[model samples]
Target chain A: MLKIHGIARSRAFRCIWAAEEAGLPYEVVPLGFAPGFKLERPLAINPNNKIPALEDGDLVLFESLAINLHIAAKAGAPLMPTGDDASRVMQWTLWTGTEVEAHVMRWGYNAYIKPEAERIASEAAAGKEALDLRLAVLERELAQRPYLVGNGFTVADLNLACVLYGPWLNGYDLAPFPKVKAWLDTCLTRPAALRARKLREG
Target chain B: MLKIHGIARSRAFRCIWAAEEAGLPYEVVPLGFAPGFKLERPLAINPNNKIPALEDGDLVLFESLAINLHIAAKAGAPLMPTGDDASRVMQWTLWTGTEVEAHVMRWGYNAYIKPEAERIASEAAAGKEALDLRLAVLERELAQRPYLVGNGFTVADLNLACVLYGPWLNGYDLAPFPKVKAWLDTCLTRPAALRARKLREG
Candidate 1:
């Protein structure tokens, strides 16, 4: 059996959603985000001490996107597709992490996670501006396609939805990018994503 | 022939390096980084208006790491091992983008890319500190092995080395992490990377 370390409330939700989409049985190690969490057992599997590390027999892997991709590929889920579609899936997944997630995290930390006095207004504003630009790109793209890759939902959607969850939670308005907002709503309502959301909320 | 957009001096270098490593013949579109560059031809392929978008037949892909992985896997290069080794390669590539690259980009922007008058010293310092912590993690891991995954060079090393190039150009000291410094030296010296570097310089 595969074991995933980290709570679903973190980036680990992406992995759990992928697992659910692939119908893979996985056990969660239940790591949290409290202070001093880095010095705990998560370090044993991930040197970065970040959440969503995966252990499969002799192999250990960290990085939530990598873990989700591996699970989707292993299960031959529609979430991954194949060939050129697979490349698009990879493109969106990587893009979500590089171009979007970082900004979302910045906004999240400043707008919600950090103490009121510790939060930097300028940084949070810059994060919001950057995220708006990126979301506009998504808006244009989503206007032409129903999903990120091909016709149906894939791991790319799962990853993007989870990353956007942070911005959504921060109460950032999604109205400007109607397509993106609609697409996100559709993605979040998937049976698998709903189940993952329940687990995360719990 | 495959086409890669953007100048070799940018993130496209990673894709070029991967192609060279895989012995794949490719063409360069020679995009530039200027104020209106984003609204130009790059947007036709990448909605994000980012460089390093790839075109192969009817398929288009963006994200340097994703492009590199597709080329490596397609060409069956030593740059991407098989099975479990491939998973490790994926883990490190994604880790490079999420952990190391972001901090390096932060430092690069504040220290070099931004005008001196606009640069924020505190943010640059924070970036440097974050990079130090991440590099320490790499140093510990590299002390046990010559490469990021498997016994030989892989696309993972190529991706990591390219990301570290920004820090190297910004004159961040690597002496404190001898193992990481040594590993980076080896990866950058590969014939493929050498060719890519030359192209980037031109």
Candidate 2:
């Protein structure tokens, strides 16, 4: 049995979706229980003390994206890439964590988390600008291809899609990005994605 | 010829060090005028317009740690773990990006980048608090082991070290962290690490 730590409303959701997609049974260890709860035991597995810790037998790993990669790898399915592009897949995955994710979190924190009175317009604008820049790059890459890597979907596309979902749900429109919008549509069409939505709707 | 795009002081140093450590023959395509510039280049390799994009033949990769991992993969040296621990290695490497890197960047912005007048006491304290928490966790982790993964140095150590170095230079006393300080000593003891320091000095 595998154990996962973190609330579903977090980056951990992606890991849960990944585990479900892989048909692997997993236990969701709640990090936020009471009002102010956040990563207590989960931090033991990961020094960062964030969320989405995965424990498989004697091995424990943290970081949502890394957990997704681990599960995808163990399942041995469509989640991973083939041939020499394995590292390329890994490269894009980390890129999402750096470029897309960093910006998205900034925007989300400012626009939604911070009270309107406390939120700085410049910070929000910077977040928007940063996300826009990232989307534009995504638009270009996803324009010619169905996914981030190739004709078919891979883990890179899945992870990137999840990152984009943050800003989109936070009220940032994706209307201008045709390629990105279309790519999102394709990702949403996946059976696993539908299940991911159902799991996240709470 | 492999062309790595990034400035010296940026996370690109990871790639710079990795290539040198891997003995990968490549050229440095320095972006940003000097050190610590966060400007972006539009519609190119990096969407967010950041430094440290790696262009190897036709494949273009960005994100410093990712590029470093790609280089490490090719070199297949003792720098990274092999076989079963590979993904585990990836997990820790990404953890550095997710936790240590972001937290330390906050501290750096306060110390060096932010104008003294604009520097808020609260912001610095908040940043310091976050760094203290993360570093405490790191110190605890290091107390148990020599490196982040397995018994050897990997990109996990490299990425975290580079990101955390900024804070250390800004006067966060590392003397009390016997485990962390000892581990840092071991890491910097490497000839490659010594050479990387030279690059920084120059």
DockQ leader: 1
Q: After superposition, how far is residue B200 of candidate 2 from its true place, in Å?
A: 2.6
Query: How high is each candidate's interface RMSD, in Å?
Result: 1.0, 1.7
Q: Please, what are the lDDT tens digits per residue for candidate 2 over residues A1-202?
A: 7788776777777887787778888888777543576447545766666777888888888878888878877776466765447677787888788767878877877788668888777887888898887788788777667777766777777778777776656677788898888788777657877776776665
lDDT of 2 by residue, B124-169 (tens): 6777787777678778888887888888887778767767766655
lDDT of 2 at A102: 78
Task: Compose the digit string of candidate 1's lDDT tens values, residues A1-202.
Answer: 7798888767888888888889989988877674445437537778887777899888899999888888887887477788888888878888887898889978888998889999999889989899999998899889889999998988888878888976765688898999998898898888888899898776
Which candidate leads in lDDT?
Answer: 1
Q: Report the C-alpha lDDT of model 1 over B39-78, residue by residue, as the tens digit.
A: 3754677777778889999988989998988888888747
How good is the docking of model 2, by CAPRI class? medium
